[model samples]
Target: MIRRLLPLLLPAFLIAAAPASMADVQLKDARAEAQAKALMETLRCLVCQGQSIADSDADMARDMRSLVRQRIAAGETPEQVRGWLVERYGDYVSYDPPFSGATAALWFTPLLLLVGGIAVARLSFRRRRG
Candidate 1:
């Protein structure tokens, strides 16, 4: 019985040991972790909504998080990492795209909508009162 259990337990133990083997790859410094988390939050998950890649538990998110730490530790600045992600995943993967010609509407549209909505409401109120 012990022998039978050993085979089953051994693989599980090995699998658990694998992450430890790569433990050096993990970012333990609080400041580094905070930078990682902040960068992740600005990234969009290709698979989920309003959910940033950092907040997601999906495999893609994990991969992205690992990639972020790797890049940061290798001396890439935060902006460079963001640019790399844009090159790899395209602008859709970023919650915040730079204000430029193609994405100009994205940055301005929400504020425009809000202003237009308030104006319409005020006009309607005046009409109703009159």
Candidate 2:
């Protein structure tokens, strides 16, 4: 009855609930694997903002790694794969997003902030002396 099937059904339920394995998709060629790894390092993990996809343990990072490997194995250059990802996810997905009109503020905001801080500090010091 139900008791006899419980053990078998338990294993099936566990398997269905388990996350997909990340190792199943990989490039057979060593060079392609290397390319995929390099590309992974350049991609930022959206879920783990501070980590590259290569260094992240997030499920999104794992999927990104799988996509890189599959694309490389299917003969796409690393740049092409990167372009596809950037197009789909926007420049934020890349650690080194291209310099362009849309991203100009992203690239220059740090410099601008630094200069503004220095100017403010200088003005504050002058006021204290006067």
Candidate 3:
């Protein structure tokens, strides 16, 4: 009976020990890790729908994570690295782009559409009422 119990407990023991064994494998430097995490969050996963690189587990997200860590380790500012990625991957890779000339439309287009829709609905309602 004790031998059988040891076999079951051994698996549990190893499972519990796993985290302590791999703690250093994740992130050793808090600040750098935070910077890498922030950069990754700003990037979208090319292969996943509506998933940011930071939250995705896809291969593309893993590659993006590696690139982000490399850029952070090389002393690139988060914004600079993001700019470089945007240049290489276009605005689709960015979860949020800086508001500027061409991107201005992105910021205002939805609001414009909402207002237009409301106006059209009001006009239709008035016509029905008249």
The best candidate by lDDT is 2
Off by over 4 Å in 2: 1-20, 23-26
Candidate 1 per-residue C-alpha lDDT over 1-130 given as tens digits, one digit per residue, 9 for 90 to 100:
9998998999999876554353235577777767877888899988885788777866667677778887777778778999999999888889878778888889999999999999999999999999
Model 3 ranges with Cα > 4 A deviation: 1-25
Summarize candidate 2's per-residue lDDT along 1-130 as a digit string, tens digits. Answer: 9999998899998764443464336677989998998899899999999999888988888878877887888899999999999999999999898999999998999999999999999999999999
lDDT of 2 at 89: 97
TM-score of each: 0.68, 0.79, 0.68
List runs of model 1 lying over 4 Å from the truth: 1-25, 28-31
Full-model lDDT for every candidate: 0.79, 0.87, 0.79
Better of 1 and 2 by TM-score: 2
Alpha-carbon RMSD, each predicted model: 5.9, 4.5, 9.4
lDDT of 1: 0.79
* Poorest lDDT segment (10 consecutive residues) of candidate 3: 18-27
Clashes of each: 0, 0, 0
Q: How would you order the candidates by lDDT, starting with the best? A: 2, 1, 3
